[model samples]
Target: MATGDNLTTTAYIQHHLQNLTFGLHPENGWSFATSAEQATEMGFWAIHVDTMAWSIGLGILFLWVFRMAAKTATTGVPSGLQNFVEMMVEFVDNSVRETFHGKSKLIAPLSLTIFCWIFLMNLMDLVPVDFLPMLAQKIGALFGADPSHVYFKVVPTTDVNATLGMSLSVFALIIFYSIREKGFSGFVAELTLHPFNASNPFVQALLIPVNFLLEAVTLLAKPVSLALRLFGNLYAGELIFILIAMVGLWQLPLHFAWATFHILIITLQAFIFMMLTIVYLSMASEKH
Candidate 1:
């Protein structure tokens, strides 16, 4: 018999969101299970698999749309998809121009791809939190699997690994730009000198250590900040949806209202991430 106190809504939702771990005990596991299940039970990898699948699918779809639009483009009159893609391209081009002064033949396209890819990934938050997972469960059950263990989180941006991976990629780009613009010696000089120039050799020796430490910390902090910002916002939004859903099926009106409000969060996070990437790249392009 289940007691109402034991069946608290918060606990229920938290349990659903909990990662499935492997081992005899829940606390001690030989390995982390992809979905909630015992080692004896067959695991459904496809539940979590769809999140990446959907993100890549949408990215490719957009790429195809833009490619086709460009292929059929005309000088006389641009209509429909061509105009829409052109507007997006121009918008990204302007951002690149504003942020990066050097030749950006590669950077412009990269920025455009980042903007569209991240926006589409963030847009996954707009989908009903349980919809895809539920559909996935149904599909799994058809293929002779238990529905209860089909755990999947659709919003890739909400995943810390995903967001950190993105930030680290940006970090790599920053390093690459720094090295490309300024040679190894120039890069080391940026870290040690410029901002604080010491007239005497003794003063320069004292500042070298301090300057290097500051630059090192700043470089590390950039990706950490970027990762946490996106992860925190998206994770919080996802948690809110889970909580709302746990408040009984009758809370449909409130759920709809919250979901409507979350649209702003989804869009804002995408824009912030994109803007931050541009800012970081701009900083890289600078002498300092």
Candidate 2:
């Protein structure tokens, strides 16, 4: 029974990690109707379902941690979880204070949430690639499907859609804050006139159009840059893991080595995303 086919080598590792895409059908042709249909057909939906569950689960867990820490307030001494939460809170507060001069009530808490949520999502990379997928496959088999047909990817950050979705949300918040701080006319004037003020009515009109266009492009670039930076690092890291896994049993040590190194990449990418978020919000709060 112990044959070469039964061995979980690198090729098997890479194959299991690959995404189940919808476009450009394989030799078998289009097997499902909708994208969701295709996902269900290949058990890709299982991965999405599991990712959502885990992300939300982790979020709720952290929320409870903060809530409990807040409720059990102590002035004399701090211990265990309180000390840990206090340290993280102080770090986030410092970043917020340095980067943003706006109200602490909103900005500080938002930054803290961003850091914690993103860190939890990034931590998913630490989980063995095969662990959750295998569990999902087994669950699917019990529901009358073949385990071999189950296809799932548990890492949320590896998903471009998910990462871009988060970036876009920050993008929307930036716009909201800009409008709130500047007022509608003040915001429009800043975009169209402040950067290229002209005393004469004729010159002002001409410069306004050009300035607005430039400002619009600059605003658009922020979210795109934010989205791509996060997506690129995470996707590349996931790809490297897959490639390394393909190196067979002899490369086990190398695989562990790369995984250890990737821990830094994960944390750095999350921190970069958070910093960019703060920078963008700060820019939005500016006069021009």
Candidate 3:
């Protein structure tokens, strides 16, 4: 945690968790943050350079692997990469088929992409928590930046913003499909009606407001839960790794033990995110 220095426990944790932030400063104009305090003060307009870089790079890696497999396909027995790709595709396709009630060409591919992309991001957690950040620090020193100013969080899912961005995109899809399957009026009715129905016209009108309030909260909760679930799990895992790293020689066994267990967590979180997306979209497509 000290990175071979005398950093206090809280400072060590804060340093590892911080993202390399870039944005405008009221005093310095546009510049990368030199401290966590400065980054927080930069407000909503600031960008996490490392989170964006790692996420986009991993995304491209996902596309390249799949593209290569598709291009190198054969009717004969498949190579290792082709076989792995086929199994992943088949797994996602089957998951979608079993869960999604409505027809959509987009769902299977979307599920596959979500599963693979998020899994890749979570997989970064298995890397030694301090490894990349230390490397990032050394690199920064070469560029005349202070080691303390160099922050790099390898796992994007640990950042709430990254997770929320993904969940909100899924939420947008849910809204899009709901309006597409049900007309605008049907969509509005779906939100405003049901869960509280009445034969009396006056009572039904009164129930509309209550129903809308409940349904709106339920609708908004989908993305909020989705984002928090992934972020919380990975962030906790990362924090533990940082704690374990502070132990001198014992870190080796402890780290591997945790990493072995973490494999399942990473895979399950990815599957859960993808599965929930399918379920939400399927619900959106329903006529009720």
Model 2 weakest lDDT span, ten residues long: 25-34
- Alpha-carbon local distance difference test for all models: 0.74, 0.73, 0.94
Candidate 2 residue lDDT tens string, 103-210? 747777777877887777777776766667777667867977655555566776777666777889999988998999899888888789857887999999999889
Which TM-score value belongs to model 1? 0.83
Q: List the residue pairs that clash in candidate 2.
A: 10-246
Model 2 misplaced regions, further than 4 Å: 1-47
Lowest-sum lDDT 10-residue window in model 1: 39-48
TM-score of each: 0.83, 0.83, 0.97
Candidate 3 clash pair list: none
Q: Model 1, which residues run further than 4 Å from truth?
A: 1-11, 15-48, 194-196
Comparison by lDDT, 1 against 2, better one? 1
lDDT of 3: 0.94
Cα distance off (Å), candidate 2, residue 125: 0.8
